[model samples]
Target: MEWLDERKMDRGKKPGKLLGNKNSKNHMDLQDIIRESALPFLPAKSLRRFTGVCREWKLQISTPFFAHNQSYSFRDVSGFFCQSPSGALSFVSLNQMAYGVPDPSLKFLPEPVDIRCSSNGLLCCQGRTGYRAYYICNPVTQKWKKLPETTANHGTDPAVVLVFEPSLLNFVAEYKLVVSFASDLDGYEFEIYSSIDGSWRISAEISFGKMKLLPRTGVHVNGVVYWSSSMGRIFSFDLSCERSTIINNIGSSSLGAVNGKLHTACLLGSKLSVSELSNAYTNTMQMNSSAKQWQVKHAVTLNFSVPDLYPRSYDKETVLFLGGDVVVIRHEKKLISYNMKTKEFTEVITEEDTYSRMVPYVNSLVEI
Candidate 1:
């Protein structure tokens, strides 16, 4: 009778154990399905809230794999980060007035700094606390880290560009920062900082012959930093190879990256001409020692008359940014964008005050 009772209890426990295992497996499957389906569609700002749902969600969102996958949805020009003369920060979305999406309320930066460049959702701000103070931050996350002082001495303000690419590597995520400037001796110099190696080093080709980097005109595309020069040249420094090469010959031009290609904006006999730099450095297998010029795919002339404020004809208006066919410029007291296709100019007003400097901004969840 005792043996019969033991067998009965064992039989009852086996069915319960099997049922529990099946339910646990189904729950894990559901979790994986949810993680895979929702992660791609969610905007970067939503990632923080979803991370708190569970420990699994927290681990998945924090992984570099998730960051890389989510980056694909970030290329759209969501908004513009505007900083006025008074050092007040405001973000204006392109679809703000139309779509009614609430403006992102990011934490204020500790100090006022000119947002110099942005790459892969990280912005590089040039602080006013002397020339050495620079901050790299994700504006959406409002997390910032100050950069190390540059090793090379720059007489003028350096053209700083940050290059960040999210990857699956958890340890020592690599970030490349290039600072191109005219050296004290009146020649071009490139000082680079690497997050993986954790130090700043000047480029191997230190003294670029007779070419000085133009102040406040630097743009990065596809892991290379390009700056217009004083000697009618557009030179590029490849962050991976740490080599410098001249790509175009645009004399004292303002440069911007549009559609992943370099565009030069220069005064073409009183009208601002937009020229796309195409087919510049394709042949890397067999090198051509001759100085290669960037082929202008097409050019568009803008109705940019000389503002009455500036008296000289040679006084070129600064091109703030170039987005697709639209060119944003500061003329007199107005911030306007000239459409290349339509040849129409529209005023871009943020609040009542005119924005001094404008750079293309895209919000993201990049951790500091």
Candidate 2:
């Protein structure tokens, strides 16, 4: 393990005298207190390196309380995990100096798995073979847990989403895996697997009549899981009440969440429009369904032509909402990020494979 050099630390700010004494015990205690308070703001990689500083620091850093505080303090988009159609996986770093993993392809898992969803730092993956088991893992720590099988069949390609929100009071990592699959009798059924109880239970609610949820478009906001549908609707499943609600008239667009608020990005002829869903959860419950829920947040016309960027019948293009100000769009073989605030276009990368899925990742210390 790499350790921070003492000489480098000594070269920085020198401590002033406390209680009129430079080397007094009170002065050392004040310094230690300041260091402990500032530790939670650092990255997980830096915290791991600082563990080698002393036994007291290691003990404090290894505690669950510290992990919880650090997770909330450093909640920035570290990078993304890109998975191709052939189950090939890769990592794209938003900032290489601050965030990364030991293995981007996730070779630490027991077998080959396809990543379904990502929340905070945990990844929900389904095994390619055998029972198609579900596994929740932390890529940074390389720790994973294989969940028990669900009562409902997830079909061949169901919409799977992982919901995990770190609590300030609760230190243990609790999460849920929601699967929206075709029902045996009707439209669609929801089966949720909870990590707290280590059990799976099929929800009593199902989708509205004949609605087919688009696979791989599930986004969790607040306590509800939202997915765009092929029938021009947005299907949302509330985890708190275990109920399903449908929001109509939302056209073809990609779903993303920023700071617990839901947003959508849609690409039209040479113009990219981004809209925010106001009163999303509350308005869905009201009987007056005629009120407009979507508010146009940002819309900018592209300087270059993107005539071929439209979705075809066979293959659909994707728009990714990265952080608060940037939206990434996959155009043919290239991935471009457009800043809503600055109105600048930056080419993230060029990929040979056109059918790649990108899931945003945040580097966290929450143990699995």
Candidate 3:
């Protein structure tokens, strides 16, 4: 392979040398093994460059099967797409060497968009102008699909969440968008848009009592979508059964998924507490009984002092649990991450203005 020849030249070796005769079956078998084992593990950018080595490499890398495998194997929180209060978007790389996007501001899209939610590598954005249309896009591949307008009215500030899970058994990149909006009757209503059907449908289940679902607080775990409410309650909707239920209150906190389980992170005084919802899926399906309680997972006190870190009003403070160990805290204009395992605190970035939204992103090749 030409990629191998480049590596050989870097090591001061002859470029044209081969392990054996070019037509040997054993040589081809070794090459196939290497491609199968290593190609999926590489970052999407490297794999894109490797496609130019030869037609065989291009064919192998472009397959949907390869993209599915690569999506699962290379899935990690690369960084966040942060949007300032003035609607300016920027990308902050957690590790610049390992991960980044070609266009952080998402200029490749048709119009300026406000990112509503992100799952896996796909981002669900709504057009800033012109009827406020919705769009699903993959930043890595620069591929996008605009969805047909929903029958239900998703208000100016909608409670939208995107759900996309990559599976080994399924190669198709399928996802769903769940929007909670005001209902004509008494309480809120849910309207879901599935990529499989390419249409929006109003769920039979409706009304989460009088609690108002908070915008931009939806988190998907397993097949269920959860949203925090202003009344300190949790509203859950199961995509499989199209049922909605209310989980027990856990006060005002941020929700995230870690190791396929639902977790909540809240700042109390000088300490940051992380808790997991044990038996989340099972409890979410059963609407009658009370959902499982949150078990304390990690409670790290903020030893270092920062101005107004634990302010009396927590409306601007946000906590996000990234991966399994790091807890990201956004206080005012400072973005800090605390490692649960290492017990270390690192300042990720300091923004010029306060950010209104920070969506964690993963670099993926999933086609829309």
Candidate 4:
């Protein structure tokens, strides 16, 4: 996370108090009031502008406390990033679409790259310019940093996931990039790159024996990362504990984070079954406890079948995101949402046939 070292300097030097009287008590009180009441509500774009309003505003917004509080406070799904097979990228505002407001297409990233995953507000992407080089970028801020290429060669199936913990840094940006790939001789390997160290190295290796790994299907939930194997086994890696465990009996399913807990959904017979971990703790001891089990939250059986979708599609559906009670599922060209409470499915309309990949998007001021 040395990319964030500059933020430490920013935090230490308080911009010389550009906005108010340096010696006046009333002006200091006014700044404090505005910082608490007004700043958090502003959009990331407006917040960036406010950073230029004065040294005080910039320092206030850059504080880790302010960033963390504002991030959790504004958890609304503001928009989504849509990509096309032709390589064009766009941002669709959910707020605008729901209100029948016409929105001009917005460019998502500075480069038209394939976005692998999103955490916090930043996206981990693969651009054409970087060979085996990954990019961590904030689409909202248009700020990006190309990550150092890993030492391992994964061939084609590199299981990559981005884990961004905004609370880790008090006054700067920080994130961890975890990559799992198979070598020609070594089988499966996991590597982690920390912004603090600014380098990548192998962390651990999984002895899957003869089992095959499902590529590009890793999900992070509650500080744990889950990846599926071909034999219906899910590999659970405790990021904090640096240990891996094999979960038995779960069939092909899409994994997602629902309310910061791990959730899995797969089709069983005619029903769409969704289940979540009973507890939120990711520690190995707690997860391995006998009391902790996956609790089925909702199961909805559809009366009709979607043509051209096989039974396996139930588990194969690309889970765009899971937030609150709504879970977004993408199957081929269509994107749909399922409500946990009502058990109703609704189609999310978008630019028809233009979407190749879609991920849940939130606006944030985090920059590299």
Candidate 5:
């Protein structure tokens, strides 16, 4: 170590002899103190200020040790509830459910938005109704991954609605952030997003008119992400292929296509099937049917007659039925959950105070 300045290190007249030479221990102590004081899990806000301290601190903050979202969950239906301008987002964790880790992708979200998933232990959130705001955040480690700044597409209403494609037999783990946006530009084009190479890029875009009944409720089947569009069309984003394919109209209007298609997702046997615009949600449309269209199966009538579920209200034409153990929904007034196994529908639960009063309105519930 370099010798201390002679004058400053004068030991003989010491008011406490020359202070021992600065060492790595002292350096590390300061880092430890700062980390312990400020919450590192939430980096969206604290990041700028934290890194502003110094270069060494910046490098240290970049490490995984300081960034993560804490796994704060609700034990039951009332365990934890998220609030959106529209309504609540609630989940009933099965006894078998396991929360791995809560990782923060961003320090602070621009505003309070929706929490799509904390899957694989990472919290994926987006802006509230009508705006395009989203970030990949881990609450535990507090490291925030990035995406191109998100904004709402004019035609599409709510900004970012996405899901993760978990690992399967032939595939590895990958997360997809799906956002519905209608560019104000020509074609008044409506497209969906798939976060590619750390950026939101257009996966599929189509000409969707005023009828905005498409269900952004995408479900992961095998390695594909299937979602319903505004006009009752079902589209699938295949990770393996990196392309979105229109899975022939299952039904014309279950989700919101005034033509009678519906919006919603359901799990059927091995294949993830959605309810058609027809009366029988269990039925699957016969692709390329000349006259006879969809045929109803007896597999599941999951949400056959339920309207007010999750975000809160759906009309006969604006809802999609899911035939599964549990069918979660967004209604016009609140968030509700239906248990097919139990044949029951839950009461209205609000995530935040705002959405509880806003009321979720369904444009169409035609089984698409």
Candidate 6:
């Protein structure tokens, strides 16, 4: 018993010392506390503050027993703030499209102006530094690699850029990286990159004059990137054979062609669908895969559409939706969310709307 409490005094001569008895009991209690805290499942919730308790506490917290609790499964940043499949919104960068998602969480990539959603959350991103010269980025984890600047160098230039992933289950899905660069000014050069060797190869020239600036949101399907140009041309690039071809002109000059940015979401059942914004205010468009192209499938009305033609629907500062849709829409100070399958839109919340002079802005919503 004395061995268990080192602070115990030799009480043979000093009968019963109250102070010594208290000290001995306190020493045994310290040992009991240490033993109880060593259990694996027991974790210190306030490990940071517990570390400042004393040097001993810090050492214990740093140990494997305590440190394990510090790890969080997911933390999303800037982009759309939405919960992951597991419902953990720890850290995420939802700001600058796919380019802004930081390291450890995603691949370091250049600023991509346009991005296409691929199978299993993978993205084909076209990021450029100067006029028409661009690199490619993947949004699955933000991995990126720069594509060759010159495909032909024939004084032609690429009017638009796109990246496509063809397969869903396998990494090497018959598809590859393709870009439409230097079409005329740079020499109508079509370039392709292989996932196996990481090389860029040029395809046979599809001679054409300066390409009409069309909607750059190119959708990838059946191993090709499809886009409708302002000059009224439907372009297709084959990833497997590394080829470029022109398809029949689709859509119409009569219908209001949204000059801003177009988004395409492909469906699986039968046809293709896309999300297009036409004459709508404060509504971030979600296009389905059933129309001639991706036409508006879901619409959320705004209190003020006004003249903000260049509508910044995705605000980097706010996490709109994380892995999935976080909001349906925001009117003035109120925010909303929607279900992708039910085709139903609902208001999630209402805020002060200070940024737009009380005008209201809900860029993107993702769980962080």
How close to the true structure is residue 249 of candidate 1, measured as C-alpha lDDT?
58
Candidate 4: lDDT of 351? Answer: 68
Runs of candidate 6 exceeding 4 Å displacement: 1-150, 153-175, 184-187, 209-211, 238-340, 346-368
Between the candidate structures 3 and 5, which one is better when assessed by TM-score? 3
Clashes of 1: 0
Q: What is the C-alpha lDDT of each candidate?
A: 0.65, 0.77, 0.79, 0.66, 0.40, 0.37
Model 4: CA > 4 A from native: 1-68, 76-79, 97-112, 267-270, 278-292, 300-319, 331-334, 339-347, 354-356
Question: Model 2, 93-118: lDDT tens per residue?
Answer: 65566667888899999999887778
* Candidate 4, poorest ten consecutive residues by summed lDDT: 97-106
Which prediction has more favorable TM-score, 5 or 6?
5
Candidate 4 structure quality by residue, lDDT tens digits, 203-307: 755644566666556778878887767777677778887777777534667777777887877654456777887743434564456665578877777654443
Could you give the candidate ranking by TM-score, starting with the highest?
Answer: 2, 3, 4, 1, 5, 6
Worst 10 residues of 2 by lDDT: 308-317
Model 3: CA > 4 A from native: 1-35, 45-64, 279-292, 305-315, 321-323, 339-345
Cα shift from native, residue 306, model 4 (Å):
3.6
Clashes of each: 0, 0, 0, 4, 81, 70
Model 5 Cα lDDT, one tens digit per residue, 18-114: 4443455688787677665543333233353457877866776565433321111111111122334453443322111222122112325455555
Q: Write the per-residue lDDT of candidate 3 for residues 206-309, one digit (tens) a residue.
A: 77478788787788988888888877778888888988887775666778877778888877656777888885455546567665578889887786443443
- Candidate 6 global lDDT: 0.37
| Residue 352 alpha-carbon offset, candidate 6, angstroms | 16
Q: How many backbone clashes does candidate 4 have?
A: 4
Q: In lDDT terms, how accurate is model 2?
A: 0.77
